[model samples]
Target: MRFALLGVAVLAVSLFVMSGQMGVPSDLPFPVQVAIAGAAGVAAWHARRSWWPLAALGAVTYAWLVVWPPLLVASYFAGRTLGRGRGLAAYLGACLAVQGVSALVGEARDGPQEIMTASLGNALFMALGTIGLPLAVGLWTRARKETAEERARRLEREQIMRAEQVRAQERARIAREMHDIVAHRVSLIVLHAGALEVRTTDEETAETAALIGGIGREALSNLRDVLGVLRTPRPDSPAPDLSPHPALDDPDLSPRPALGDPDATYRPQPTLGDLDRLLDQSRALGITVTRHDEGDPRPVEETVERTAYRVIQEALTNVHKHAGDAHTDVLLRFADGELEVEIRNQRPHGHPENLLGTDLSGAGWGLVGLRERVELLGGTLRTSTEESGGFLVSARIPA
Candidate 1:
């Protein structure tokens, strides 16, 4: 309602300013302009739905009085904001009603000119008030609305893009954990299964191998889901050669001879006592993994031993790919209540470091997870490129 009064005051002041432009007389008296303005405000204040109608009437009246008429357009624009569609119609209707009043007023006057001439001029002025002003105002409203919606949609799209980026990061992290945990377990299973296959010929022994194979198949399935559907691509594609998810496939355990019953997975843990024998075991696979020990002997926890063994196993697995023919050295040290292990390798001259057929850059969190495992046990882990074109990982865990 207050807006209606402001609209009226704006219209009158504009008319006062442009009075010379329209050549309208100011003899209507200050009190008269105030009364007309008040009446228009009263009509519009409570009836905002139809305020444009009354303002449109005010514009027509101003035109008949020969005052600056452009100011009438303000009320039309203001009414559009205060009210919506119906206000425009109401404003137009009110303008016509005011024209009727003007005709009656002309009939009562004693001007020398014919009333019909003045009446026609008043009607033309009414058309400009109701039609010209409202048409332009409605168009302005439409354009404003369109721009606002575009901004809203743009903001929404940006939000969706940010959310998708976050989701991708989370998926990568999940995929990393799955690959690390599953790979470590599967490697051991394969190692032990190979052992069992060699030393056993009994039907029961065959049955166990079948079970291990079953487990491997299940692991492969899990890895498939956690990783991407397409791990590697066709030769024709330019995409990267990487696993989309973790490997759940069975571990490679084909080397076990059918001679010894060394069921070591769920029994007394495997440790350095088994290291000497294990090196000989890996050598049979045509992979050279030399071990070196230094520093004084120290007592360590069983968990640390198992974790250490698994770390080396993975390192060797990576070597089988990257340095199948590389001279590899495994160093273990115990000193000052700490246990440290360092694995370093130098590929044989002119041999490809990527002999395993797996992409090494894809080995990101494989080492990171191993490092985290070590750190969780109050340990420190470090990996860096060796000067001799080799790679080294050194880990130290408190005893």
Candidate 2:
């Protein structure tokens, strides 16, 4: 709006000056000239974004300054350029309109060629009038439009980035929720299993105690697998694999104590402590359970200690569930700074029984939790059925 006012004021001063040099009557009726000037002023005032007003005011301004030939030509070109393309076309039509009016008003005053020949200045104005001002102004307007468009694009990109940041934060929050739920419930199960094992001595109760130990070890393994995503690098490892433990399930909240758990007096969690007993329990279910050791059972960290216990626990549990009345081999290997535990059992020819009465639904989560636990302690776990019809789970944990 300010710029429109400025352009109009500039045009007015130029016209008044040119009017004098062209020798138009100073005594010309103030009323007629004022009326023309008022129209130009109004057009300029309304030219906020509409090209019509700019074209209209510019056309009229040129028509009134007839004698000072340059002003007439400048006005025509300026109007056309002010609104290029369709606007320019519209401006040309308006110019022709103003020309028609001047022709009518001065029909008796002078002839057309005579009007052109009257001034040498008009000829010079025509050459520049053809292209100069219009082209320059058009490019200026195009550049201004481009700048505005770039600014809008930048704002849109910023909005998308902010939205993505919010979504990532939400995903991390959900991941945290899942971890807490599994950890809390599985820990409670281990607690009870440890307590019951301590107080039970009857044969049936002893079997139940062995099963509880197996389940607790399964839970610990599952917890490790789930937590594998957060595996931190140890100085001796390039890629840490928390091998032994796997996955977890929530039900009946059984208890199995942790390695060094104060509730169980930090007793060694079922590691080598129950290898013979684990075989006895599996064999009692009529599954042929065998054992193997590759190297000496030497000193190892609690992380390795607990993971080893969990691996054997889940393997035997799987045999109990899916390979009842089948041959099972439990192999332990201590090599380098790592301990490897492998459990392989033949797939039964018939439908397998529970062998023990724990929920099968709860059994599925075992491997996943085991992997998490193993990875967290710089270990790796692999499980699949072998070509000979046995399911095999193998884990190696750093000591």
Candidate 3:
């Protein structure tokens, strides 16, 4: 819209100037003068696209009638579009040639004395004021615009680099804290569990101790992988080695996957297929848990399945903490284009205060982490207490 207005303004000014020049009594008819003025206006309006044609027309008309608007407009646009190279040199050469031709035409009409005195002086002054000034302003404007754009791009790249540096520093700090606190505590738990497994005589007690120790060892392995990642220089590097390190090694612990194996670095994530084992683990801990399926089962993306599994795991963990031995139901409904997971638990049998023992209490970030995970996959998680005093946790994820 602005460009259209600019074009119209240029055309209007060109017509006004041309009309003033042609207003003097001449041999041309009034209609012919109007037609010539309209043509000059149109040429000035389109000077941006091809300024040379307008320049040529303006030179011819100026030599004959001493009109200058179209020539000034063409010179401004030529400076804007043409760089300081051969193109600009060629245009200046043409302008000089037009001045020479105009001088010769003036000498033919008036005498050589008039051409040498008043005519030459007026022509030089007009060329400097109309052409040189506008051309210089156009070139300066273009240079200023190019410099501002380049500075803006440089600032954007610098901002990105600073952001990455802050993120790397934060990751390194977190890795150090986790290694100092959580890793040390987990290592001690694994050692204690290993001692219990070796010293126990009863078969069932030994088996339970063995299971506890195995779970602790696996937790330490996963923690080590996470720390390795946080310590790496680049985020896109290959996964860290999963083989047991000397600091975390135990003779009684079961063997882990071999080092240097192609699949060792990329461990399989838990999915819906592992839901049965998860339920069994809760049942073994004396929790009454049951699972039900609705609608037809369909395969979904691995990320969706992983998030669903985590939702159920975190919900069950909450049940153990807040509803001791409460009846829990796990529902999986596979519907068109989506999968829904719901875990509902009955109210605790005893006082809630008694059920929430210090050992079973958590840091309370499980649900928050689960919500982040679900939302990242374009899903929603909801948790609420029912009127009957039961608690419900549900997640809906796109397949």
Cα lDDT, all candidates? 0.59, 0.60, 0.74
Off by over 4 Å in 1: 1-32, 38-75, 78-94, 110-118, 129-131, 162-399
Question: Model 2: residues >4 Å from true position, as ranges?
Answer: 1-11, 14-18, 21-27, 49-51, 64-87, 90-135, 155-159, 162-170, 173-399
Question: What is candidate 3's lDDT per residue for 278-331, written digit by digit as tens?
Answer: 898888767899999999998899999999999999999888777878889999
TM-score of 2: 0.36
Better of 1 and 3 by lDDT: 3
- Candidate 2 residues 354-380, lDDT tens each? 233346677668889999999999889
Best by lDDT: 3
Specify the poorest-scoring 10-residue window by lDDT in model 3.
18-27
TM-score of 3: 0.77
Error of 3 at 359 (Å): 12
TM-score of each predicted structure versus truth: 0.38, 0.36, 0.77
Give per-model CA RMSD: 14.2, 17.8, 4.7
Alpha-carbon deviation at 121 in model 3, angstroms: 6.6
Q: What are the per-model numbers of colliding residue pairs?
A: 24, 39, 0
lDDT of 3: 0.74
